[model samples]
Target: ALALYVNHRVRVPGTADIVYWLADEWDGKGIFLQDADALVYPYENLKKVCEHINEKLPFVERIAVYATAADVLRRTPEELAELKRLKLGIIYMGLESGDNEVLKRVRKGITAEEMIRAGKMMKNAGIRSSVMVILGLGGSELSERHARETIRVLNEMDPDYVGALTLLFTEGTPIADDYKNGRFHPISEFESLKELLSMVEGSDFTDCFFSSMHASNYLPLRGRLPAEKERMIRQLKTVIEKADQTLLRPESYRRL
Candidate 1:
């Protein structure tokens, strides 16, 4: 997570040393770098981190981290392959929203096509790609467009996993400021569920696991795409039709 007071990206010094120390202490099979964008580290440094971990802790089977579309694109094919060889197994990337205008508004810095390319790149390099899209990101204005385009992009990417998160306005963020000024409107909890429903219904994936099981979401859903798609869709429709607050996650429980 970014520090509340500092806006710019901050790279912790000796990240590899830290990971090595943690792995040595914990002796776990996996190491997940929970930084905002682990791939943002320079390629040589990233490789060294992996190499150091493998050399020091051969029992560690895999390494994972959060990444961005830009981060994936910045690495060369050779570098990605090398990382995969070093057991850099999976990456979680936030697609946020697929509507171009909505993406521009949020300053995601990459088009939907670019995001798809990045995902495909990771998959081609034998790295599992888990893509996340934010529900209600377009607010009430572009909700439908956001869902439709996001489904389209997900279909194109055919990622190994898809995680759906609902939009939450932090107090100090620009979106929250817009909400306070009435410049932006957030969709209701039920509306967010509807958006998630559209994504589950419209998505066409080959053996992909799709879910809205994040803490930020009102409804929690998880299933293999295409196979359990109908079951998941029916579940969402049932919840929406009932519209019972008791049936959904309470606001107090939701968080970023």
Candidate 2:
């Protein structure tokens, strides 16, 4: 099981104290330090927190967090190795879309090449990397390019885990405003599923676990790559061909 640590107090009072607080309040095998750029937190400070968790709560097996390509790039090889040694087992990064235009539109601030380097760096340092891609981030206009290029980049990164999430707009966000003012048009649910199909069909990985099991997705799929690749692809194809809405999650149930 996993415990979430997202309070702003985690930043002010320090991560180690928060770990102590969590240890008192919750019991779990893993802790998901939920921050937008958790790795950007000072290396020494993070290392200390990891050390405290391992020492104070020996049952916690993994420490995972959300990170960005820029955050990963800022870390030196030695620092990453040190963090891995301290039980920073995995990192979850958002590689929202692999298409350059989409990346620019979203202002991700890092190129696909840089993202590949970050993923490889984590792998070499013995830290598992889990990356996420948004299914309909390009809206209807660049849907195919988004899917195909994402597959290409994922192939290059070959992360330990790949999570496929469908696009959703939060209120007052620029993308949400764009949708309101006719500047953007999101693909339909089935179209998003089609994009997912393309990703599953095109992805090539050594031993990664690929999944579209996020709550935002219409369908849930998970399997080990290359080994279960064909079976997963066939499953997606059949779902798409059937076009059965009842087989998919209802829109009301989906959330960010």
Candidate 3:
């Protein structure tokens, strides 16, 4: 809240929130719940915070959330309505990929079926949801399946948004370790882009928001719905089919 005030960005009003009782590292000790996934406070404490914000910064419009574990919220349809009544706006969830192979290889710890359930449930609660997909997560062995299964899950979830992110072996991670030992082979930027488009083509989602405009992405593409989605995918594919690999983004710049 203070940061938003300081930034003078009244753009999207509501604040983001999180609840993770299961990851409460402080739960075992005398200390009740500790912040792990994010700050987890008592339900009463949360109500107080919302009340305080409403009383003071009434302009605050929406409350965005990214709760990894939906169990903690224990939110029913009525409860979600209560949250909206309290000015909670949008909720984002990561359906990383529908491919179980890619998910486990990345230690995502969430199954495709579970993601499908969670995402659809979130939409049912009137909370806007976001799903993320990673290209090249399955290496060459499962790349095609990764794209195919990912689309399968997306159709099942049909989130309001789908974020397509590239995979990279960042230094100091388990992925990096695998890279050094030749256990993993990183895909080129071009193939990653193709894989992203494939994920979309194989899927039958209609209005999902698409974005890869992050700095790390080789090409930052974003759009909404059928037209914009096709346009963005075509634009990216053109870049890949035409651009020379030797002359493409240099290693100093590309991450994934």
Model 1: residue 239 alpha-carbon error in angstroms:
0.8
Q: lDDT per prediction?
A: 0.88, 0.87, 0.66
Off by over 4 Å in 1: 1-27
Q: Which tens-of-lDDT digit does each residue in 12-36 have in candidate 2? A: 4344674656655765568777656
lDDT value, candidate 2, whole model: 0.87
56-80, model 1: which lDDT tens digit per residue? 6677789999999999999999999
Error of 2 at 131 (Å): 0.8
Candidates 1 and 2 compared by TM-score, better number: 1
- The per-prediction CA RMSD against the true structure, in angstroms, equals 7.2, 5.4, 9.2
In model 3, pairs of residues that clash are 13-61, 14-62, 63-89
| Winner by TM-score | 1
Q: Residue 196, candidate 2: how far off, in angstroms?
A: 0.7
Clash list (residue pairs), candidate 2: none
Clash tally, candidates in order: 0, 0, 3
Instruction: Give the TM-score of each candidate.
Output: 0.88, 0.86, 0.76
